[model samples]
Target: MLAADLEYFQDVQNAYAALTNLHCIITDKQGNPITQLNNDPNVFHLVYDQETFKEVLNQWTRDFSKINSAIVYDALPGVKVIICPISIQGEIEFFIFAGCLLESTSKNTVQTYFEKILQNPEKANAIFTLIQEYSPDEIQAKLRKINKMAEVLIEHLATQNMKAHLVEQEENLGELLHLIADGNIKVTAVLERFLHENTKLDFVGYARKKGHDQFVIDECILPEVSSTLKGTVFSMGEGTLGQAAATRIVRFWDHMDMDPRNLFFQQKGIYPKSLFCFPIILEKEVIGIFFGGSSQFVRLENDISRVGKLTSSLIKVIEGNRFWQKQSKNNLMKMTALNEIFQVMTDVEDVKRILLIMLDLSINLIRGPFVAVIAKQSSRNSYEMVSRGLTADQIENYSSDISNRYFHNKQNKRFYHQQPVEHITSWSSKVLEIPIAYRTECFGFLSIGLSEQMLKEDELSFLMSLTIAGGVSMHLLEATTKVKMGQTVIDLLIEHQEYIDPDHFKQATKARELIKGFSGFSTYGKINTIAVKYSCYFIKYDEQFLTNKIKNDLIIDIVREYKLVADSKLEFSQASLNVQVLSLVWTYINEDENIDFLLKINGMNLPLLNEFLAYLSHTTVVESEIMVTNKPTANEPKISKHLKLSKREIEVMELVLKGNNNREIAERLYISEHTVKNHMTNIFQKLAVNDRSQAIAKIYQMGLEPEDVS
Candidate 1:
């Protein structure tokens, strides 16, 4: 039995992959994986995983030979498995096979097979969702092409075997293999020298350019011939080189008249009696073509054994070069894209405009045709308000479906899921949702379509790293902008502090009431803290307790004035002047103590904001919280038995005690307003109270305690 090492088979497998979509596997005579079976994503995984399929595949591998060519076996429903035999020293040594090739036109049958295997309808549906369907004729044509290529591959392998024995005896031939295998010389250079020395003929090489689909003359001897053929493009099946490439077989023309499209002879006018052509194949597909011609009789068939071995070695080097070149290109593109993103975020001040740029550049960065940025609203579900390459109808469709919201998770999360659209002809149905976030705060999602030609795992990993960095950069920009605005507010407060007179109680009261108009920060506790802390600079500690009374009376007076302004239909900005005045008064009222609170509230860097705050304010000793009692409470006997509220009613009443409105209470408890109102009515009847104020008063009066009320 002839045995090949795992590395050798792996090289062959990689080379064959460049030529076709069908998964190929090379195995030893015993049917073990050559270099370990590819884990489940490959066809071999399926063949090896299922016992029924494995038995059929193993039997076919054993029976395959040069005599029988190959044996067809069952793999998946409607999919055919074909194994071609490789012979070495007059015995079958290896078996190469292609699987998951559809033999029937029915896609349903294929879907059913996967459904049975996986037992998941959704997964089965998704497997078929992204598949580009092929007709029966197309499938048959593909199979025929693959089968012919397999036959040529088998012949090439046999030729290598024959040449191996010859190489052991011939030192020059062994050196040629060593040189080409070691990548010391280009495969074309060695092939050209070998052909001229051994057969007295020049070699011509044709390979596809990196980005272009058409084949071009790559390497050749004969300066005149090379000059004439340079820059010439050949489409598949157009000329002799193309024919050799398309067929993946040796093409021979013993007479000049036999091949009319042979460019060397046609363009350079160098007529030869015989010409030999062969394809440079990798992974089962043609990557380049080779041609050699002689002015006299040249035994091409006798030399095929040596030529095939050299060609295989050349393929390895070419593949390696292509892989590195593609990686380099992708890295450069990624860096350029990331640099552009950084520039836009750094320079752009408008958050909306910055977001738009981010959404636009993300499409090109990921190479996806469709892209979108979906942000979650505070009150409702996440929505797709902005998108690129999507129609109005598609946007509307996405907005209505809650499932389309991929950025709903409060923590940073990512999803790469395939979404099936009604229109299959759209750019792509596959989608990836990457969370745009900083730390634990997710701002939005970057959604993009997935292309069929996806980035390799390493490239994808690099892209994800950049994406996370980009998200953090965006978050920092937003925070920085807020800090800048807060600084502006601080400047306004310092510049206008003298405009308000402390002795002018009307102006002071008006300012206080306007500040109270801002419901978000007008709580009794917050107002008292602002007053006590700030007024300490202007008032003594003994009189500091009177500052709270002054702040409270001013707020009450301002509220009465605001109601009069509302009755007279006053301009909002005029009413807003009161707030502006209050900001100045409060700045002075809190004295230097407002610095820390302002810095914390605006999310500014503590050290930096402290420096600015210190430079703007007159330094004063900041006091600790002074305990102050609210409305007097009278001790009462416990009356817990008199109030029998259901758990839900007590929950609502506790929210009422915290001064939450009906909507806020409902939202906090995750209930409806109508339900909250019903709870309130029940609590009112249980406590024999008229409104919220009396209900709370009775709860305190009865001294009824509730568990976990807070």
Candidate 2:
């Protein structure tokens, strides 16, 4: 506790003086006279020996604050004053002085002695007038009364100081607790304050015991030393701190150089003489060690006990903070994964492609071997699926022959299923299957292999939610495909209504009405019938047709107009024509190809007759090999529009094509390694490719030119 402000306590000084009828002055424990309470000048100050009295007063002040009783001292040769020591809590905090009398054998002798000290004969008698002469008995009574009053004042001051000190300590402790609660104050900061306020030390450090026998100094705060000691690790019994850690006890010694194990403070110009080491115990185990050094020998038990209480609490606060930080990081990662999966599902247009992305995401998220999606075929009583590490044939056979034999009804057209129980089967891998259904309609099933660590309960629930969302999105995309197909049929029939036969025209008109009502395929059947009556066939691109097997009279595919260059040489008249034409595909073969061409029964625009044969003309034809290539043409720029890449993905892809690795790309882009990796994955997924090599090849095929990363 800090010393009280004695300069403002003049009332105590005046009270002592008024009761004793003597001038008084007060001073503190350090012997610095605070101030004179009474400043009246008299002949005693003028005639007394001033220089000799000032010297005596200086010596008296230094010797008096510790005294327990009142004592009389000669201020001058014959003049005297009484000094009383004032104490609080058994330690003298202040001293009170009172002027008493001047003594001599006779008035003339007193006058002559004062005249020699003052060097003025006129002031010699004036000094006797100011001095209060008292009998020995009277002086004794006054001294006793003054001593009693001074003691009472000291007791009062002691009580006040105790209250102030208690309040100060409480406030300091409250602030420390608040700092811990905020988590902004570190262990090093707390140690700095504790060492400064509670102990006199040149250096202090806190170290954590790690591994088998290593102690790492995590937070080191030193006032007199400027060298850094943090992150310094030492083996057990290697240094002062290490020894304390090994023994699990407080250690203290002087002559630091005598002990070669003290490595903390040693210099050519300055040597540490003393040091202390102690352990912070929690639950019968030492969690941390405290080490500090001073220039003088410290009280071992007093210093170690004081610091041990502080460090024990400090360790607990540190542990709690680290636990919360770890939990927060885990939660953030989980949320990011969930958000990324949901975004990929709702944003991608194709249902099959979305399933492929989800499979990749789930495999990484669960650290598993494979994930699969099995969708029921629309026109057959079977299932079609996409998977990783498992073939569609394997999935179809398993669900049909092995799984359905016991679990599903082969005759029933629709099946409702929750997740299937695990069992040994003909398949080589274990699998977990959950139904992918939304509301009342069951679309398909999701199959995940049980080859690695299964997800936690909450993670599994999130996975289930993702699957349900995927099913709903797929159902919507399926409905959209059907609507587009129905609209295409309606457009075809309406475009050729005039050329169509009268009966066919009425059928085509009715088909348009059915398509508008969204009665899918029932309307297409009617339109197909009408086209058959006109001797034209409506055919979707069949896989068998790729080998020149023609099962229909009209084949529909997305054939470019330029691919039909051979048709320009056909021989024809306005009425006479007999020819066969074939269209070469120059674009991607889409599964849902739109109708872009119409053919008549006689392969002519107008009716052909035998009478118009005279006008028939022979035409020359040139043939060339038909090839579909994503390779850029001579006139086409290397940067083509076919590769639909986002701006950020394109930036990353350009760097990838330049042969920059993930780390290099992250450095160039000023992003984290994890973010660069995520971008690379996104680029691969968007390009419909797997690794960096495949992604580069696919982009090159789309005429993407390489650019410098810089």
Candidate 3:
């Protein structure tokens, strides 16, 4: 029994020895040491102290932090040992104290003990001598390798945790991408979800293009805080995210509080403590930027790498989606262009009108700030109106400037020699050049303005299409302008007989009174030069031509006649008529018609007297008998034409014509009923009318309607 007990004791000693350098001490319940292994026997007494012994025995009841630091005390003369509690049937039996090691021990010797423990004591002792003979440097180097192995084990465990986290993040990212692709998810929603799910990070903000600037926010992910941060500019190199976007790189700032002082954060009120910004690059261009931050400073290499990888992956997906989006947009733009072309072709007769509509459409479609069609001017200074999105004031100013510089200057050879240059305006120094063609005799320059963000190939393509479409629209507009001019000239000739001839004027009045019982037909005889030109050029010379051609065929006749008679004696003759007729039409046409006709013919040439007369005859005619009968009375009526209407009658008549009730008229005119009645009774009797419609009709007949009389 003594030999057996000794063998068991040797086994325990060998087991203790297997943990070489690492002190091991076993103490009984009575606080006496049962076994101790180490070069220093003093470690057993120190480790088996009452306090340490009780702590080791109370493992089941103690917190983990309290038990984690248990180590042999004598290793450093004061350090305690790590204790492993051994129990027998739920009762404290003995405590195994270990983990203290002298700094002088060779790390390889410790490792050899670990390896030898798998084998036996003979092998363990054999390896121990070689390990113990190693120099301090070699032992440290060996310890580093062992530490590296431990680190590998820890890394494996960390990797498992990372995999689980990455899986969840991927799912979240996938959902966000789905929402973005769906297009129903707003930018705010996407950012909010990302920040909310990514509990480890605080989402700072995002940036998007708005007109000529970038719209940035501080806490768009948090709605409660977004309003305070909106409408802020994140210019290039301005903030972390801005810098990242500007440089097209990932930027990591350890501490934002330590950032260099600048206007970016100070003015923008975006002072983050720690920040990570990544550029959302697509097609090698930074389209947007994303930022994540923390309120406290923390460095996470793994997190940085993960974010980089995730951003890169997301960028790839976004780029692919952008490609498809561009394709779809291009197709949609093409279809829209075609539709606009069709609508303009069918809807308008004036090329200028069509061009204007086209400019508006292009501006809206491309979402550009400005659109213009620069066409070759007839004179060095006089470019024809092609199309523009410029305001009236801008058009006038531009036209005046062009006229002053180039109009009719024979020395200006550049007009015939050079190609039109299309330029897009910039907010500051840089002007982005949109690809366009500039050829000699180029129809016009089509220019559009874009937001500060770089445009993609598809956007450029759409712009090119707009320029091309402008050309088509311009052509259509010119053709329509000519047709409308001719129609207007015809309409004037048909209505205004007085400007044609006093005899024809009387006859037209009689004819109109006989046919429509309305003397306003004479108003149509008012002839603008453009109208007379249209009559000369486009009207077929015949009796039917007089009736058909001189009736609303004004624009066509003007352009055709101008072209036909531009160089001949008839050209001069027609030119004179064009001017005289335009003047006469200005004087006699209804106010609305005059305004419209002046707008059309304000800059056109005139026709000669003979052509004007000819146009007038075709346009206006009276019965021969009426002309004969009215010959004597024409001079007298011409004198009476200047008679003035009384202010009261004018006021009463105007209100009556406006359909105002008598009391309302009285209130508006500030007159009593008896006076209003007197004025109305005289107005009716003098106008030769009894009822309201007839009175209105008679007023129109007298050519006294606001537009007609004016």
Candidate 4:
């Protein structure tokens, strides 16, 4: 689709060049080569690469749609120039370029150039001399007439093409109109075909008013026509079309010499005897004059009126079609814009690429000479160029200036409104400021040079969508990175724990505090569960004894170690060992056959133990506790009541009644220094004097024995 559009535009440009005897080329706003006719391709490459040249071109296109022979010296090093902007559908689609003169040239070259320079002082001087020799007043009048003719020529061409494009729904009609208005050969062919088929008169040729003063004709058609009507404009009330266009009324001349009322008609040259003029009314405004004349001396009042009516009706139809076509095209452009945005969303991941794509798309849609994405800098004097169409060196220079003004100053957002800079080049010749913001966070300002055509709502909406989409994607990417980091830490913790020593597994549990905190898993239950799982092997290996004393010692040790790990100053005094005893009993019964000595020593019977141990080994400690606790509590209260003595007394009586040794209690408690002797002395005194066996016998008599406590 894009290629076909370019080809159509190229054909029109070529036709314009051939008919007008002028060089022409079409270029993008950035000065990049799109298509060229009767001009060097390298010219576009050179101009586009030169920032200064592009800036000048941008300025020229902004002011007018046509520059017949205007001089623009800033483009190539050794080139004179005439440039015109060819706007279509509210955009500068192409520029018409002509002339390339070197600084130094031969006399013949200068003469050729002089003839083409429309208002050159040298040519004016020669014409003025001849007029002064003849009649000074007449000379001044002729000069004015010539200038007016030039203006009319330019205006006629410009308005005709604009009007034709306005009416026709034909694809590439804009280009076709441009070619016809410029008096191209193809347009002449088309007009010749129309005239030959529609009229009996010998067609002289066609001419279009370029402006208020100048008229242009197809130089290619001048030779074949019999009359000298090419490249000429009649003074007001002088010729058929000129009189009608100047007076804004219809005019007809039956004979050049015989018509008494047509005082402006001259008999000095061969001229059309009968002529009719009609005003081309467009949108209730007379845009130009249309003349259809012949040498047959025939009356054309009815034909003139009919043609005038048809042309007027045609203009109205064109205007209506243009209005709706523009509306529909804009709608299509908006839809295309939406589709492009969707594509960007799914295709881009790299932030830099996304930003560049956004910038490129914006420039294309808006048809601007420059577009850039600027990122906010942290420093007060610097900003980063996230993406831009400017050349590398140009971007570097612009970045340096932007850094000094906005980035270095640490301004959140700033607008540079039409601030003229020698360095930065764009189409507007004036800077446009648009701040790039997401929510309240301002990234930076996006700057572009708008041509004569301002950006529409759809263009702005497209830009806004790009900014929002880019910001959201960046945010999501950052969040994903953090999540990945967390997962990595968790994985490392799990891996490292596998290599940790069973006895030193407590350290791993302690280290998990850091991981839990990092991962946001700081709830009490969760922390406790993790700590227990991580340190379970250590507890099982070291504290497997079910005896109350040993279990009580282990609990004290565990509490002390926990306090040390926790870095707490608070001490854990003696606590009941019942829970530890139950835990230890469960651990021993649950040990596998390979470590079954643990169960054998805990009072398991041989064959029955073998069968039960196998079954119990597969069971969890929690499940075994459920089984044990559910057995029976019937005799438990009676036993608990008989063992109502103080803890120290129970210790002494159990040892003494068993007849082992008094020294054992003292050694176990680490309370030495006659503590065991005193405990024995108190036992005998409490039992009413006695030997060790008598004391034990009395304890049995009093029903205070191991059976009751157990």
Q: What is the C-alpha lDDT profile of model 3 across 1-710, one tens digit per residue?
A: 13322333334544444534444444554445555444443433433466675555454234322332222233223222344444432454444545444335445545454455446655544433332333446434444433332233233334444645655664565455444434344545556655675565654566654444364553355333332455566666665666676787777776677777333554545455666766765434566666666655656334554554444434433333444445676555554454445444334645455456655665665654455544553212235554344677665655454444343355643452222233323222222222222222234444454456655665554444444444434444444454444543344344333322455455434423222221113333333433343343232234454554444544444544444443233423335444334333432333432222322333333222222222333333333335554443432332124324466666666665555667888899898887877777777777666755455545543434332222
lDDT by residue (1-710, candidate 2, tens digit) is: 22323533565567656767777776665546675646366333554366654554567767665578888887666677788888764777677777847543444666687788768776766666667777777677778877875766665565555545534544454455445544556777767766765555777778886786777889877666567678887878776777787787777777676666554456322245677776764324466787777766665455455444444445444443443345456544654554455445554667677667667656765655567776664423346567777666776666665336433555533444334445443666777666666544566666777865765644454455556556655655665544444433333333323332455455434433322222121211222322222222222223343123322222232111112322454322221111111111111012121112211122322111111110111100011113434444556333334555566777787776656788999998899989988988887777777777566545534323343111
Q: Which scores higher on TM-score, 3 or 4?
A: 3
What does candidate 4's lDDT look like per residue over 1-710, in tens digits?
15634654565556555544334565664455577545443333433456765665566665544433333443433244555554443455455555332333333444454446634656533422221121335333433433332333334334445434323422232233333223242434434433543353444333445565444433212233544545555544444555676676766666654654343323323445676665544333455455555555677674445433333333322222333235567655654554445445434545556567667766766677677777653212234565445678767766566556654565524333122122334222555555544333445556666667876654554454455444433433433443333422333233333433443444444433323332232211122223233333334333333122123333335434543322323222121222222222333334422233333233322222222222333233335556564543666522234434455665666555444465766666676738777777766776575665455444444433344443
Residue 679's lDDT in candidate 1: 86
Better of 2 and 4 by lDDT: 2
Instruction: Predict model 2's lDDT versus the native.
Output: 0.54
* Top TM-score hit: 2
Greater-TM-score candidate between 2 and 4 = 2
Supply every candidate's count of residue pairs whose N, Cα or C atoms clash at under 3 angstroms. 11, 0, 62, 39
Q: Candidate 1: deviation at residue 598, Å?
A: 31
- Runs off by more than 4 Å, candidate 1: 1-326, 365-369, 376-384, 397-428, 451-453, 485-710
Better of 1 and 4 by lDDT: 1
Q: Candidate 1: deviation at residue 546, Å?
A: 18
Q: 1 or 3: which has the higher lDDT?
A: 1
Q: Of the candidates shown, which would achieve the greatest lDDT relative to the real structure?
A: 2
* TM-score for each predicted model, relative to the true structure: 0.25, 0.36, 0.30, 0.21
